[model samples]
Target: MAALTIFWDDLSVETALDFCEYLVRSEDYKLRDLAIWIQGSGGPIDELDGSIGSLVALWSWFKSFREQGLPGVPLGARAAYSVITGRPLDSPLEEGSRLVGESVAHYVFKVILSLDPTAHWAVRAKSGRIAHAWDNTPGISMDGGKHFGPAVGFFTNYPDRLSSNYHNAYAAREAWDDTGLLQSVELLYLAGLPSRPRSTSTTESILSPLLRDDHVGSGHREEIPIAQEMPASITNNGPVSAGAEELIFASVGADVSRLDQAAPLDELAVASVLAELGFVSADGQSVSAVTLLSHGVQVQNVDGFALVETHVAGGRLRGLFLEPMRPSEKEWKSITDAFSALGEKLPAHLANER
Candidate 1:
């Protein structure tokens, strides 16, 4: 095998530190020698200690690794152990360094095996490869590539690598062996496989006609009390003066009846109603006459014989009006005709009433 060349991506720094600590504690390298090497790396010993402290703090902050589905082992335990024991886990010597470094993956595999000795063949295969790679080249990249190929292969081949025990792991390794590609592809396939469809059942209930009748039997179901109060309709008894091109009318009250009762009219609906009344532009519609009477109510009173009241506070139509009684029979007929035409477009309930 080409000497496994491990390249550590930024994410692998912590893992590398952990592995280094593991090697040191295992007595593979001398701590004093490692310290000396650190000293020789152009930084003062105090700086190295500060750097170590920062790394430890980072590890401590990421203590929720267990919650994120990682093992419960404190992050910097191995490193701390090495420092305390005054041992160098990594060697400056090329061969000894390589050997100790390679053993890191094996140690990890052993730790995993200790948990479940009869781990699946796929797991064993993956562990073996990782151990092999670590022993051969301890500096693997975290990014997916040939450098981190074995780790990716292990995970990709065994989709349940982190979940299920070694059975799936073995299967993935076997598939990878059969095909020359890394096990990662197989793992991807297993992960991407759709789960079985779930079955759903719905039940419907039918009520007896008698029960339906009983439910609506009470006619007093929150009826709005139509008070005997009615506003006096405006009267335009004056002669047809030449300057009187249009007549304006206005009204204010607690109750404003919507022109269309089939469906409730909102502010937009009130605006729509005004547009239909010719007071507003029919083609390029705009809220021409509609004005907020107070923050509590909206009033639309155009310089035509029409007034519409909508309760802005309650956000509902309260009343509508076609005002100014025409003294002439011809004018009355014209007003009635205009109202009838407008009524046609009103909601079914109000249109029916008209």
Candidate 2:
């Protein structure tokens, strides 16, 4: 069926992190994958995600179109992955294939990010018992499995989607079209406006989750139980092309790549944010937890990699970016209790040990 996954499509980790400031540790797998790419010299990590399987699906896929023992992405998939990530695409090398490690990771990350969050909202699948695990939504059938995202162009953001009639009829009928709200998005001249014509509103724009520098100081304090949902195993797909990756590996790399690089005071600024978040210090002060929960501490991937990602700052706003996985109220309380305990002042004897 036409399994729509818009609920969490644009659900940015940064937005989820902003949902509770530094109080609730925002978890983001996407950023973690990006970090690994930077660490790999703009290449895919050799390790496999144990949650998915011991066999490295991505590595196997990349190796198929091996060029000089290095697999590269094709033009079509290359362009697609770039567009979906909101980046520009470049042509593949005619003489040799491009290295797809970085681009493929980014593409997969975006798709998984969109669908994984759906688990948190699968209340109906709980079987009347609460569990920290993920249960697929009843109506959200990802028929193509791992290949579905690429097939539907979800990875590349290709304009052509599978025809609605080709989808499972039963699932389509049972689907929730946002109760007709989504259908309301139509082109209009508006009551009064200039000669410009543009898509007025969309579920992607008006309703998409938003994240920004201003959002860094946002959200209230709360405990967020770490989520560890494993995505369904994806069989290997064939190789695609590669591009220049991100603007420059240097921007995301450990070295800032320039003498005039901006200072990483973003962490200190976040430390101040942690103080506001009520993290108690070892000396009976607060936000010491911020120090403990620095950039790569929270929100990990299936491989236990933290999604502590860095991005190019074009708007003069430089800082860490990330998301949150919503927890059940019970889980929330449990985490909150843990934080509350951590917030407690250290005992007299343990002061030095701390």
Index of the highest-TM-score prediction: 2
How do the residues 1-354 of candidate 2 rate in per-residue lDDT, one tens digit apiece? 222121122212433233223212322322242334323443333333321221133333333433233332234443211223232323343112222333343334333334332212111132222221222221122223222211212211111122242334323444323332122111011111123423222223110122223433225423332322222221122111121011211112233444125333333444443344333332333343244333333321221111223332432222333221232234223333432343242110101101
lDDT of 1 by residue, 1-354 (tens): 112111211112344454444433432222233333323432232322211122222122222221243232223333322222233234223223222223333322222222332321121112221112123322222112223223422322221222233345455444322233322333322432223312121121111121233443223322122212211222244343232222211122122233222233334444544555444322223454244222223232232333333333344343334333222344434544554444454431112112
Model 1, 309: alpha-carbon shift in Å? 3.3
lDDT of each: 0.29, 0.27
lDDT of 1 at 320: 39
- Model 2: weakest 10-residue lDDT segment is 345-354
Report backbone clashes per prediction: 19, 14
Candidate 2 TM-score, true structure as reference:
0.20
